[model samples]
Target: MPHSNSKCWDFCAPVAGILFALAFAPFDYSFFALLALAFLFACWQDISAKRAAMRGYLFGLGSFGSGVSWVYISMHDFGGAGALGSSLLTGLFAGFLALFPALAGYLSVKITPINNGALRFILMPVVWILVEYLRGYWVLNGFPWFQIAYSQLETPLAGYIPVCGVYGTGFIAALSASIAVEIFQIAARCDISLLSHYSYRTSLREVHRDGPLKNLPPLIMLLAVLWGAGDLLRNTAWTYPIGEPIRAAMIQGNIAQDQKWRPENKINTLLKYKRMTEQYWDSNVIIWPETAIPAYLDQVNDTFLVPLGNDAKQHKTDLIVSVPVHDADPDKKYNAAITIGKEEGMYRKIHLLPFGEYLPLQPLSGFVLDMVNIKLGNFTPGVINQPLLKAGGYPFVTLICYEDAFGELSAQGLPDAAYLVNVTNDGWFGDSIEPYQHMQMARMRAIETGRFLLRSTNTGMTGIVSPNGEIIAQAPLFQETALTGTIIPMGGMTPYARWGDRPVIGGAVILLLGLIGYRRFFRMAY
Candidate 1:
């Protein structure tokens, strides 16, 4: 009630936002999201764009800074950079990411009419989603990790995921939060008057009669209808089997990043994989993690390939494995995985990690490895339209590390493939929950497509994921193990896989345009 207490509340507001985000992490307390929404609502009461943006930024900083601290482990422990450099890099990334929430908070305050609770509720989710979509594609490359919708994966609200994707789930969550905030405001009698330094000049008795609550019933009904439709879509079977089941094996070599590329360790790495695969030689298809070969295909010579190829052919097995490939014309290198079976070909990774794979503003080689102590620092981008691989008589989409996490990429590439195959090296993050979180994103992709997803990771979380976001099989973290499973390939597209995020993005754009038009034509006349 006092100014000093209000200041303290303002300072503590970001704590709610941070806790809400942390609650979504793997093995986290999800109930904190309720407190997060309350804090946001309190800040909304202030009705100042600047203050709202500041609160949002502070929240974002805490949310991402603590949740994604695993980035430091990758840069410092695995990338060969020291602790100070890793911390600096991680700080810069977190600071940049925080700006998106700042923008969302500012827009939410600017467009919301303080007296009109209905407008506030409607606009907040729309604005939040618009900012999130921008964050997914605004920079050199976008990082769409740990979106709020992801927290709903294990909840009944998860039904919304297939229809609108993660961003859509986020919109619903924000909308729910806004509704909760409005209800709180009404019950507490903390109206817009609380926001002003001078108050009680206007009688609330008359104002309350003509306010936004009059339209609340219809708005609530609309939300119920939309949520019902989402649930219906979730329960409906929109896809069918494209072909018979394919028996597959995913090998988890658990190779250390530091030792993976070492010449001295090459024999051991090769033998380890060979030994693991020998047991599963009868599998229709077998997969190894990203860069499992750990050397350029050209460097291997026939000495390596002749035996490997002949063995696969003799066993009548399809081996899908990753190796580095060198392009001579451009004098560039690429991280690639090729399928060796009845037919053999390669798929190069289209998206390269900025500093890890290639250096910016340099000649694509030498500089990054020399300066940053990271290995494999000269990979080139793959061709954009590479087709899905045909292995063991089934077409399968393949995604390398970090590639499967991009919803747009998966939507575009996986429709034609009978199922999705993701190979990654999560040893870079050590034993952090990051690997589990990353696997969860892959599961979301599966639900979006209605296709079974097979994920093979080096040093952890390797598993088979079904179309409903269920983990069919998985290995323990940091283990040298192999898993064999039967997966049925499905046909027919889920709403998301066919249409992608267009519906959600288009809805956001239309909402924004309509808001602009409304303000211009019907300038609030009091």
Candidate 2:
């Protein structure tokens, strides 16, 4: 390749990354992801494995740096890290995330046969989705934010949410991107002489391979089936309306973090939520954001909890609030969801944030986590496989903060949960896009599970989401507002709720390895 040509590919790499970010919320031109990915694949053409990795990293850098820039705000503004230190840490986190894509790109080019049709249209997508899955499952406790599948919630591919989880949608999205490149490559060699010459030579080299366009029909047919099935699933009521709509109020206390837990401010926090909810007494369900009480469960019980629960019961309304619960280890507590009215049960958050919830490699990371107050740092992870909380005559479960960001973890509650709830305090990220992104991911959880989701947040994005991932009503950012809406309780499980992502991801792995094996076996024998 000419130096100028290579320069063009390098220059366009970050643009692809930035374009990929637009596929996600706040700027959801979901279809742009295909363009970004197809452009990226084109850039990789005739490139060495190392160059592919370099391009992938650059693409990832732009994607994560822009998409998750809110991490810097959360760290510098709220987490208490110094300006320079926070910026560096944020960059490091993004850089680390970029490595997964870098690795995927390198491995993909290396393992995939030379411009093989199957590799372009199928193998690369598997590798990308697998890398994302591994990255989410590996990084500390896990951060499942900003995945490619999360971007496809609007596309027909979203119909696959139940059957394959978000990863399946992502796989299709990636494959589509590759197909775009294949089509373009074919167009570039429009002359039959050029294509025939190239095809005849490549045919001898590739195993189970035909001309790129020749193999394209099956790919298109596969997409048509998956997409049509997704469209069908979109209209299909995997979960049916089970009960009458319930009046729910999401109370945003709007308590400033600095003044949140001061003994002097305890009265203020309690009274703020109390005063706000006093008017919503007629509502069947009232909820508070994560850690709305700003105190330990026992500490609040004497001064507020018991009285609040009794008041809710008296009003014939069900109230759910988030509070820190004292664990056996005093230094480590639980970020617990405790209910106090018509129906009562407790759910502690299972997927803990690495640096935020509990520092990994504590001795080293402890200092960084301590940059800010980290009031809830060192919190314990909730027990896995817990039953859903019952409220308002419907079985539901709560996802604390960004727990809903991971569809698989949230889906664990299954067919038993009729509605989903998310309690978060996005004030930590100020007025950035975090709240909207969080809300977007939460909405995906509802769609994946075939249930409605209620988000109660501190300082914004509090709303009601439908089973189809639509926001019914949402509160304004940084505002002290109560969001009230009626949500139908649904029953029955989507395929995702019953099977999770194992089947989808597992099939990708098997197919990818099988393709590699088939290629290798043919090379050895022939």
- Candidate number achieving the greatest lDDT relative to the actual structure: 2
- Name model 2 segments beyond 4 Å from true: 1-5, 192-226, 367-376
Off by over 4 Å in 1: 1-5, 28-38, 190-216, 219-229, 360-376, 522-526
Cα error of candidate 1 at position 103, Å: 1.3
Query: Which residue pairs collide, candidate 2?
Result: 79-372, 80-371, 80-372
Tens-digit lDDT string for candidate 2 (218-254) = 6567757766877787777788987899999999877
Model 1 C-alpha lDDT per residue in residues 1-526, reported as the tens digit of each score: 4331266656776676578666665755655664575566557554678878887788788777877888899888888887776788789878878888888888877776555565666787788778877877555466777577777677656787777788887788778777766665554564665445334574654354455444455556665776676667668776789788899999999888778888999888888888898899899899999989877888773777657877989989898888888888668888898888565878999987766676654564355445655554767889887978878788788789888777767877656778888989888888787887788788888888888988898887899998888898988888789988999988888777777788898988898778766655555563
